[model samples]
Target: MGLFSILNYLRLKVIVTFIRLIAKWQRRRLRAAQPGPNKKQISIPSRDPGRFIEGYLYTPPETPGSPANKKKPILVNWHGSGFVVPSLGLHDVYCARVARDSGINVLDVDYRKGPEAPFPAAVHDTEDVLKWVAGQGDQFDISRVVVSGFSAGGNLALVAASVLRSSFEELKLQIPMAIAIYPVVDITVEPAQKVVPKPIRPIPAFLARIFNDSYTPNPESRKDPRVSPALADPSSFPGTVVIVTCEGDTLAPESNALAERLKDGKRKVVHKFLEDVGHGFDDFCREGSKAWEQREAAYGLIVHTINEEFGHSG
Candidate 1:
């Protein structure tokens, strides 16, 4: 590692250690305050044994319909933590709620994060999970798979879809749709510049730089299509893309830009702009609040898209 790389690594180590400590406390409180639904904790073998990936498969409660007749669709979700924290304790309630509301299998991924396994590691882990899901078609019904993510995870979702699209013919994998919630699609642009209509809580440039450095380390890596999906060809994306942007979020501009590019490329794209809310309003805001309402609306859009793709009428 070079001097800058070593410095970045050390900085990430310290920050991640502090964040993990806080995350531990947050997880305990969240678990107590908002208990998640029953989910099977399963591990997916990865090429890197040291950085094995796990996921929580949240299957909705059985309905009157028989399993043989109704094989539920799967939603593979990647949780957001700026590519540092694990998803194991962060998105429990959100993932369970998605499965419960949509009646689909929710696989909440716990992929390798930065400062330990950076850049292509998380992307590779996501691809591996998708391949594993494909192999479990009997269980997950991979014929209808939707990948969704929030913030940094959203970046991973788009990149993973692009990677899968490149190999879809050989892999026989088709990502019917994808949802990116306040995604960091362009690392090249300054976060402050990306803000539009001004944010209630603008992301600090220092923090954004930290996230970028920790995840990508090498500046040149930031230009990679996997790191910055905005740099990729619009046609490389999967069908029916949903880009959710919060008006008060510093990242909204890039998200909107990506959506516009998709539209320009004649790809089906839905752009949702939530006014007066900051980044992660969907995950952190209280229910019945305006932010929460918009968040719910976004989820409704996701469910609607899935239903439409499956040829199910409202």
Candidate 2:
């Protein structure tokens, strides 16, 4: 490995080791506080040898005499950890709530994170999970499938949708929509754009660089569409795309650019900008706060899109 790769490896080791110390306690507290999904754990074989992908599937309670009871729409969620940390357990509350409120099947994937697995691993694993879900016609209705993520997960979601569009032509699968909440769509932020005036900057320039370096060690690879979906062809995106950005977030500009690109491609794009909030407001803010309220609204839009696609009256 080269010098940058060596540095990235060292950084990954240090960060992951620190996280492992507190992860167990954190997971215990999260599990105790949040009610879990209907199915907690399901392992599926990955293309990578000796590595099995684990996911949590949440099936909403069935309503009597409801057509949706026979076939429920699928929502695949990817939790954000900035590519270095694996925090799938922390997202349990959000996933469970979405499943309960939307009355749809939610599958929260614990895909391999970076510094260990790196770029293509997470993207490939996401595609594998979608393929596995598609094969389960009896269990899930892939007709109205929605792929969503936050932060690094958001980047992965876009990559997954693009991959599914290009590679799975025989599957004839089209993700109706994709929801990316405050996503890091662009890894290559110009130096001038990095120094945003204070009060609106949520992610510091140095920290963003660290994330990009750790996840994508090679500077050239950072521009790859799989690593940065903002650079991808807009036509590769799903028909309907929902991008949620916070006004105070440094990443908002790229998210806006992505929405503009999608619009230019003639795709249906819902661009939501939450004023005064920072990055990770949706996942970190206390319930009933303005941030939480905005987050709920974003979720409502996602559910509304799903219902409209599936023609669900309820």
**Among these predicted structures, which one has the highest TM-score?**
1
- The backbone clash count of each candidate, in order, is 0, 0
Pairs of residues clashing in candidate 2: none
Tens-digit lDDT string for candidate 1 (203-301): 778777777777887789988898999898877888789888888888888888788888975667888888878887765566689977887787777
- Please, what are the lDDT tens digits per residue for candidate 2 over residues 30-76? 45236553766888788877778888888776667777547777889
Error (Å) of candidate 1 at residue 21 is 3.0
True-structure RMSD, every candidate: 2.4, 2.8
In model 1, which runs have C-alpha deviations exceeding 4 angstroms? 26-38, 66-69, 311-314
TM-score of 1: 0.90
Off by over 4 Å in 2: 2-4, 19-33, 67-69, 190-192, 195-201
Positional deviation of 103 in candidate 1, in angstroms? Answer: 2.6
What TM-score, over all chains together, does every model reach? 0.90, 0.88
The lDDT per prediction is: 0.77, 0.75
Quality of model 1 by C-alpha lDDT: 0.77
